[model samples]
Target: MAREGVTMPATNQHNEQASATPNPFPEPALEYGENPARFLVEELSVDDGEGTSGELMLARIRGLETIELCGFWLAVERALANKESREPRERVERAIRERKAELEEHGEGLAQTEMTPADRRAVAAERDAESVAVLVDEGGEEVSWSRQSGAAVGASR
Candidate 1:
């Protein structure tokens, strides 16, 4: 089900490969027998508690291509810079700078990491075995994700 006020560009994975026109956001290369590529582009409508609204597009990409990932990060940085609020914009900018520094130092090892066919199979099996549930605090201001057990396993901000 699609969310209200958010639109996704229509794309067929199979057709994407054959098209002469390159996709603005293309999927990263995958290993043999690896799972299909999937990414998310979220447009958030933020209400300032007053009538005014601001919007931002956040992209979550998973791929092996470092250059394409950097390009996507640039897009996200540009979007965050254009946001109306100063707080979130500054926070995200700082985070991006910190992350870039960290990546610059350790990215060589990351670039070398690759998933084997067996590793992909194990990941798929693990995903299939796990059951996930979202839990909300009493005031509904905080949320967490729990596995099969009701106890909170990970918190989401």
Candidate 2:
């Protein structure tokens, strides 16, 4: 029986229709090995909104589809009784998570930006002066300093 205004609901397999037309979404490009999975964010229970049932306060949630307790699945009454005394714990956890993420993200960039001692010295020398002196042992192991400034042979003469 169908209502006048409301149409019939979809089938259990929503995508399967009688007609064999082209599917808008083909098979996924990447191969998913056996036992596929989904990514989900779990938010702790707050205010009056609770877990599976309104009465069951969620301690933690595992996955998107299969949401349950963080570690243990507690009965609604037990969970409500064992609720957090205060919400400061969540804030500390949030700060640690943010800092960890920032470090992980910037660690590589920091490594890349760092220069070796030799490289740093070369850069500093380039910035400091246009010429440098090369000390040579010319006179029977006697050290002699000579400035290398691209100076001309005429000046030497």
* Tens-place lDDT digits, model 2, residues 60-126: 2212111112112222222323353433235324433444454344431122247754565676678
Question: Best candidate, lDDT-wise?
Answer: 1
TM-scores, all models, native as reference: 0.26, 0.16
Which portions of model 1 miss their true places by more than 4 Å?
1-68, 80-88, 108-157
lDDT of each: 0.39, 0.29
Which candidate leads in TM-score? 1
Candidate 1 residue lDDT tens string, 1-157: 3344432343334565333222232332221111112221222346767642322322222222233344455554454444533333443444445555545555511333486545656776897776564455554443534323344434432
Error of 1 at 140 (Å): 57
Candidate 2's TM-score reads 0.16
